[model samples]
Target: MKEEQKHIEALHDIKDMMNRSSRFISLSGLSGISAGLCALAATIYIWPVWLAVREKLRTGGDLQVYPYPATDVQRLLIMTGIVTFLTALLLALLFTWMRSRKTNTSMWGSTAKRLMTNTAIPLIAGGLVTYRLLDLELVGLIAPSCLIFYGLALLNGSKYTVSEIRWLGICEIILGIINLWFIGYGLVAWAIGFGVLHILYGALMWWKYERV
Candidate 1:
């Protein structure tokens, strides 16, 4: 019996080593948590501005949500988004690096490169599409579009990381599709997709991986 158990353990270790070599498994849940918090903070700070933008789009004569903001308020809102994204990315990188150190994993590897490439394609396409939407003043679809694309990116990259991310991607896609009907509530949907979903996924991952 002991011999059998030893053989099983060896098999498990071999499997684990193979997984680590092929996948970037050192991603920290704290990264997601920090990102979610940053998104929520940005959402809160920009809520009023979003409200005004929605009102303007609904009533303003031009009815054009240009790539460039027409008002100081709108510009500030844009800045807020940029800042939030940068902050989240910075924190995420920091946390991931910390985890990689703890696990003695290489932060830059073929697996990580593949993950980034897969994730970037969707995000880059989404950015271009979003700009076109703004040019056309189809502001209502922007939030849903972002959610969908981000979810797709997550799905694309999830194969290289934790399995939990795929579920998060699915949830984001579902929420984005549902938000299509609630066009007036783009900000709310954005919060739910980016902020709330991140928090839930992060918490679950932390509980499962980090708590121990």
Candidate 2:
């Protein structure tokens, strides 16, 4: 019986090792937290610009937020979005890389490539669709589409990583769907979906996985 138990334990250890090598499990919850903070800060910074544009248009009796914004304002908004994305991307990569190092895992391996490929497909599709929407001036749909596609990407990639990500993705998709009816509050929805949800997910993950 003692020898049988030892053999079983050894087999279990080997199974765990194989599982670790095949999956990218070094993701840190701090990465999500940092990304959320960056998103929230960007949203806070952009809120005033959006409000100022709305107020300016209101004075001219054009209170609708969907109308194409002034050229400078439009450019500013686009720049802000790009900067926010880059910042979040940078923070995520930094934290993830740190975690990988701490775990003595390769950050750029076959598993990572698979994860990225699964994630990028929906995002790329969403980006192309959003660009066309912007061209057609259907800007209201942009936020919802982004949320939905991001949720889908997360869902697609979650199979390769932690299961918690799938729940986050579901929440995001639900929020995006609801936002469709509330187009007037697109920015608010975006903030909640990207900023608030990320923070919550990060906190939960940290508490569950990182805390003693």
Candidate 3:
């Protein structure tokens, strides 16, 4: 019995070492929750802007959100997106770093580098394409494109992180594709995709891995 137990313990240690080498396992669920809350706040703040846009499209007339001209609506959305993204990114990095410290893991290890490389490529490409879309005045497609690209980023880097992220990526991709059929409901899509999904995923992750 003692020998068999020793063998099992050895196998478990090997598995742990393999996982540590292949993945950045120190990510905290709080990162996702914080990002989600930021997204939801942004969504709430931008709901009025979305309503204004809808009104403008429906009436085919000049519209403005208070002192700004109709043309400024897109600019306003872009600014909001930038702020929310930066804030979320900052919070995510902070939480990740803290978790890495707690776990005594190297936050900037080779696995993390590979993960960032895979994720950043898709994100940078998406940002450029999305910018072009904005310049071309294809605002309706912006939400779906953002969702799809971000999904690709997550999926691309998921091999270097927890497997749950892959499912999140898949869900984001599916939601983006579905949003194509409901362009008028882009805000709704964003709310559910970025806000609700992140919160749910984070909560699940905490329950599964961080509960102790």
Candidate 4:
């Protein structure tokens, strides 16, 4: 019986080593939480502008949404989005690095590169598409589009990380699709997709992986 138990332990150890080598498992849940918080903050800050934008779009002439006579709201939201994205990215990197150190693993490796490449393709494509949408003033579809693309990116990259991210991706995609039915609530959808979902996923990851 002792010999059998020893063999089982060895198998488990080997399996763990293989997983570590093949996956970048050092991603911290707090990183997701921080990102979600930043998104929520940005959403709150822009809520009034969002209300104004949608209201105007609902009633204003169909020529355009903003910059016709030049307004600060358009620039404000763009700047906020840029800042929010950068802040979330920096925090995510910092948390991942910290976790990697704690786990005694290298943050950068072939697996990480693959993950980044897979995720970046969709994100870059999505960004370009979003730019075009803005250029055409199809503001209603922008939020849903972002959610879908981000979800796709998550799914693409989830192979190199925790399995739960795939579920998060699915949720994002579903939410984005649903948001399409409510075209006037782009910012609201954006907040829920980026802010609420990320926090939920992060909390789940922490509970599942780091609870010990």
Candidate 5:
């Protein structure tokens, strides 16, 4: 009886260790779906405005009100930064809520902290660089570069998350390469890459992991 109890305790300890080392536990499929939906909505909301500005630029009309031409590139970058930060916050909240219901582990634990820092730092840096290049009117390649670097960040951090996420990262990189041929359609490309891709990925995750 004593030996049997020891074996049971040892088995429980091994299970606990395995749980701690696994990367996919804190990830919530519903959160992915929600984020994707939000991106799609945001893209739909922003598209008309983007089209109007582009039409004006094509017609050689004044762009004073658009803010992109007159505002320093850094200001535009700040806007991008704000958008990125808000998106991250929203996703973080979703992750936290899902993890709370799905597991005993805290979403804000060391693992999550490491994941965010690793994924975000490269993205932010690449975004700033892209903004600077855009400001210089050296813009034909900016969107693709941004996508590629963002995908790199995702791929690099995939070990701390689901394998599906790494596949998505690979897709993003491929899409970014294809986007190079559509330089004049940068806004549309951005919408498809960030907005559409997220929706698809999120839906898949939700269906596969969260539907139960």
Candidate 6:
């Protein structure tokens, strides 16, 4: 009996060790839901204000009242960069804290480090190129291009993470194609694709996976 008990304890130990070695533990559904909701709220708050500003520029009579088109594009890019960076940083810190609380392990693991590095490279390169293209007014199919590449990135990295994320990428690609039909609403499409879809995915993930 004692030998059997020892064997059971050893098995448990091995299981625990395996769990510790696994990646993707920081993917908490609750965290996803919270982040998504935050995105949605931010979109709701910002989009109208942005539209109002654009409308003012359109109607202000003074052609020079608005900055140069290039200046406006640069400003938009900078704002987007700041917002994206802050979102990433905030999520990272939140996940790190949560994971530390749950498992006495460092959140900055090889998997997360690799994931961030891999994801950032293509995105940064594509974003810079897209910005230049937009500045040059070569925006005939920029929205679709961005969507396709972003989806590809997500799909490529999905193997290291959750399967749902892969589906999200596919959906993004589809949405991007749809956006081509309404090129005038590119900003709205982007906001919906990223902000709305995130909330929906996060809520579903939380409901199905995280809820006990």
In model 5, what are the clashing residue pairs, if there are any?
Answer: none
TM match of model 3 to true structure: 0.93
Off by over 4 Å in 6: 1-22, 49-77, 103-105, 138-145
TM-scores for candidates 1 onward, in order? 0.92, 0.90, 0.93, 0.94, 0.75, 0.69
Q: How accurate is candidate 4 locally (lDDT)?
A: 0.86
Model 3 lDDT on a 0 to 1 scale:
0.86
Clashing pairs for model 1 are: none
Tell me which of candidates 2 and 4 scores higher on TM-score.
4
* Higher-ranked by lDDT: 4 or 5: 4
Candidate 4, residue 5: the lDDT equals 100
Q: Model 4, 10-100: lDDT tens per residue?
A: 9999999888888889899989999999999999998987877766666776523432323577678789999999999999999999888
Off by over 4 Å in 3: 61-69
Window of ten residues with lowest summed lDDT in model 6:
61-70
Give the whole-model CA lDDT for all candidates, comma-separated.
0.84, 0.85, 0.86, 0.86, 0.69, 0.63
Query: How much is the lDDT of residue 200 in candidate 6?
Result: 78
* Candidate 4 regions with alpha-carbon error over 4 angstroms: 61-71
TM-score head-to-head 3 vs 5, winner: 3
Residue 37 shift from truth in candidate 5, angstroms: 2.2
Model 1 regions more than 4 Å off: 59-69
Error of 1 at 91 (Å): 0.4
Residue-wise lDDT of candidate 6 within 1-212, one digit each (tens)?
99999999999999766755654455655555555555555567567655765565457544222333446654764476468647854884686468556756666777666656666766777677767756665443455557766776767666555558788788878988898776545556666666677667767876775565
User: Model 4, poorest ten-residue lDDT window?
Assistant: 62-71
Alpha-carbon RMSD of each model? 2.3, 2.4, 3.4, 2.0, 5.3, 5.8
- Cα lDDT of candidate 6 equals 0.63
